[model samples]
Target chain A: MRSDKQSRTPMGLKIAAGLGLAFLHLPLLLIFLYAFTTEDKSYQFPPPGLTLKWFAVTWNRPDVWEALGLSVRVASISTVVALVLGTLCAAAVSQTRFFGRETISLLVILPIALPGIITGISLRSAFNLAEIPFSFWTIVLGHATFCVVVVYNNAVARFRRVSGSLIEASMDLGADGFQTFRHVILPNIGTALLAGGMLAFALSFDEVIVTTFTAGQQATLPIWMLEELVRPRQRPVTNVVAMVVVLVTFLPILAAYYLTRDGDQISGQGK
Target chain B: MPHAVTFQKVSRHFGSVRAVDAVDLEVEAGEFFAMLGPSGSGKTTCLRLIAGFEQPTSGHIEIFGETAEGVPPYRRNVNTVFQDYALFPHLNVADNVAYGQMIRGVGKAERLRDAEAALEMVKLPGYGARKPGELSGGQRQRVALARALVNKPKVLLLDEPLGALDLKLREQMQEELKTLQKALGITFVFVTHDQGEALSMADRIAVFNHGKIMQTGTPEEIYRRPKTRFVADFVGSSNVLSPAFTRRLGGPAEWASLRPEDIRIGAEGGHEARVTGSSFLGNATRLTLDMAGEKLTVLLPAGSAVPAPGASVRFSWEPSALHLMGTET
Candidate 1:
């Protein structure tokens, strides 16, 4: 038997939910639609015509390849760096209390909370002040600042969820610090760290604002698209590259989503 | 024989709150010692100190005659069955039990064998492949016990290990725990707030309150001869005679404690009281009486005459039945 409220889907709520989803995702759907459009100069409302031509056109472009290569390299290196630094930061913050501990956490998370433009401008000025030339390493360093925040958020939430008793129990059972970490803490946070790393990777791969200020000569995919948009080269080629970016960035985001969906639940706890 | 565990004037404070006040205690080797107290009484804090989870603010602790001041929990020959069991969620039953051996660099095959043997000891044999989440509450608790026992430490520290179980399961585990402790002959330091649990399972019970031990004795001694008003009231339901009444009754102490069963309710007795309430408690009938305006409880046999409310009653007790105790705030 169903209660009066159990089965009814209110019309207002249904339309509101539909509008909210559309407002967020419709532009992304349009990006996919334009990737297959035949129009090269102007974006037609209905895409005017559809074709598979841009896919091939995108494969042949060496400039596109160079930009993609740079983007992939920068994102890969940034994610690796973020994972190490972020996990360590999360562990220290979650496990110990010291003077200015909360302040340290706030400072670590500040980059992500501030607008991307502010982070970009600040990094640019800091680099200029230090006389550090904008290069591949500079771009990676800039991306890592925010990437670390993403990983930190995930790892700390997970570390907090893990019971302190398990660590104590492991140590009492004759396991040393490293042994306890290996046999207990690592397994507990493994999925969370993976999800964090994946999200960081996805975020770095498509990063444009920070990359724009940090990359002096390097043309990452977003930087190249910006250039192409300004110069008006076979515009469909840029749209085709956008398609690749969507797919590339979409995978890690998808995996991260799945990883975290049930990540709150530990193996022994639910039952 | 050396004591299995000892604490000398130990204290642990968190900020301003003294979680474990300065106190002294000793547990004999191969004995089932229980620390029984209410919440915030520092019983759990003492257990944590022995497990090396918390360091004493001052004073000393020794395990088996060795100073435990700087030794980490891993170096100490002790294992714990935590209050929530604290079994590793990532590992299956066998792997969880085998963790201690694995850390010691034992081969996988041998550790699995030992784990199985331990599971058998806890009577959860052959459930090794199952995950901790797959097991029921009682089964997971047994897995935790098995995991700790596999280490074969000199002492097993159980911090309310059965605290999460249902009442029925808890009683069953209590009996099994007593039997297991006797068979293993290892020092078992059990902490619980339930006095009944402490009485049923512990060879010696240490009653705690306000970060201090109120009394430490055999369960019989604790039940029969509580040393303070706190212990008398805390251990079981007892008629605590007021200071004036105690002095008037010719008792030596400021206050006296008497168990309900110790009172004789009959016309032949000397003391006179008015029955205020009566209730049947299966095997016994308990009557609440007002004697000189102070309430006293008397336990009568199940078949005895029921005393109606407002009836005048005569009750008396032998001089030896009174356990005298000091005052309290």
Candidate 2:
């Protein structure tokens, strides 16, 4: 029956899918094309010359390396913190029936759903009111706020998929609470946790808006790119850094997809 | 034998819904006991209470003569095979079976040895390396059994263990489990909605309904003489007839219950009735007759000529074959 419908798919749908793919990738392709162009400041379609000079220049820059290292450190630290906090929050909220549970879940998810600018401004204001020094820790804290939402969502979904009977069976087999969680619950949700952590790291790696507010003078890679784009010297190298950002972010997204691919098929019982 | 597990007037209520209401039961040591009921009849809740998954709202539960009021499931000397066979999907069969011993701080070598032995007991010796998802339903179920039984608990609880299997596999597993129980001589408390399963495996069957045990007796005693209408309907197919006035045959509140096989269709001094329907059942042809504004079904031996629909027939059975039940409502 599905094959019958597939054979009759409308021409409009095929064209729509084609146009949608082009709309999504055309900007990224243009960015890649401009990264190799010889032009210094202009954003023109057909460049006069293509050169590998800017790629070399972007590779040797010490500031670029520093920002890259900082971004990696911040993203990794934030991902780990988010994973722990998010998994704990997901487990707590998923298993218990308590007053204000729905409200707490809503508050936990609100940070990601709100506009990034709003979260940035709110964090900035909170930091100002508390007289806290803005540094690497602040940037990590800013990124972790939104990263927790990603990990929380994935972990909660995985926890919900886990059958309650499995926990009961583990306990019945003479396993204590911690042992049941280790042997039964952790293995079932491990993939989801990994997927969520990868996505969160990717999101934090190139995040500009929230990082801009939290990182006072500390230049993350995205901040460095923003500074390079505004200045006039060797502007094509900014595009080169942008291309690097795309690659850095793209691999994790792919990894996340692969990690979560089998999770979707785990629901229905196989014959 | 002393009771291995006892529920002393235990009750559990989920808000207003009384899942297990003020119940008392005793499972004897080394006996295969079954709790039989329909869905939502609290049989599983009773099993959970005994397993320490759910604490009773009111009264106490005792396991092996010890009060189980504050004991957790892991500390209790009982293991359960859940209905869905909740085997860990990530762990191989050996690791899954070894989990309990590992938690108890058993050495790695000892744990592996015991897990392999348990796997062998379930007749899946080489299946220790396979994931639960890689195994068939029956194989997964056996792995779950191994996982639970490897702990060697004093009592084993099975909650509708064969519910997920097909008819043939369920029957086969029933005999295998009964044999395993007898060989181990551990107290087995099995819960199932299938009366045939309970009757075939259990040394004593407890028929539960509406959060209460309607009757508890041996399979033959419960099937041959049901004390209540609910027990009669649930245990097996019965042609419940409302006698105009039943005379007490023996003990107080005892009335006759006519088994379909025992009620002969063309016997001497039988009541006359019109045949309403007939069903061919290989060994016997079940005939439904309308007698005194009530439908009565009788089983006639195969190869016997079946009367046409609306045809008059006579049915009778010996008085000794009639089971004595408690007073009808």
- TM-scores of the first chain across all predictions? 0.88, 0.89
> How do all models score by TM-score?
0.87, 0.84
Error of 1 at B269 (Å): 3.0
Clashing pairs in 1: none
Q: Point out the worst 10-residue segment of candidate 2 chain B by lDDT.
A: B243-252
Residue A87 of model 2, lDDT score: 96
The local lDDT score (0 to 100) that residue A115 gets in candidate 1 is 90
lDDT: worst 10-residue window of model 1 chain A: A262-271
- What lDDT score is found at residue B141 in candidate 1? 93
lDDT of 2: 0.86
- Give candidate 2's error at residue B60 in angstroms: 1.1
Check candidate 2 and list the clashing pairs.
none
Q: lDDT by residue for model 1 over B1-329, one digit each (tens)?
A: 88999999999999999988888999999999999999999999998899888889999999999999888998888998988888788788999999889888899999999999999999998999988888998999999999988998898999988888999999999999999999999999999999999999999999999999988999999999988888888888788887888776667647889899988888874678899999889999999998777899899988889879999988888888998776654
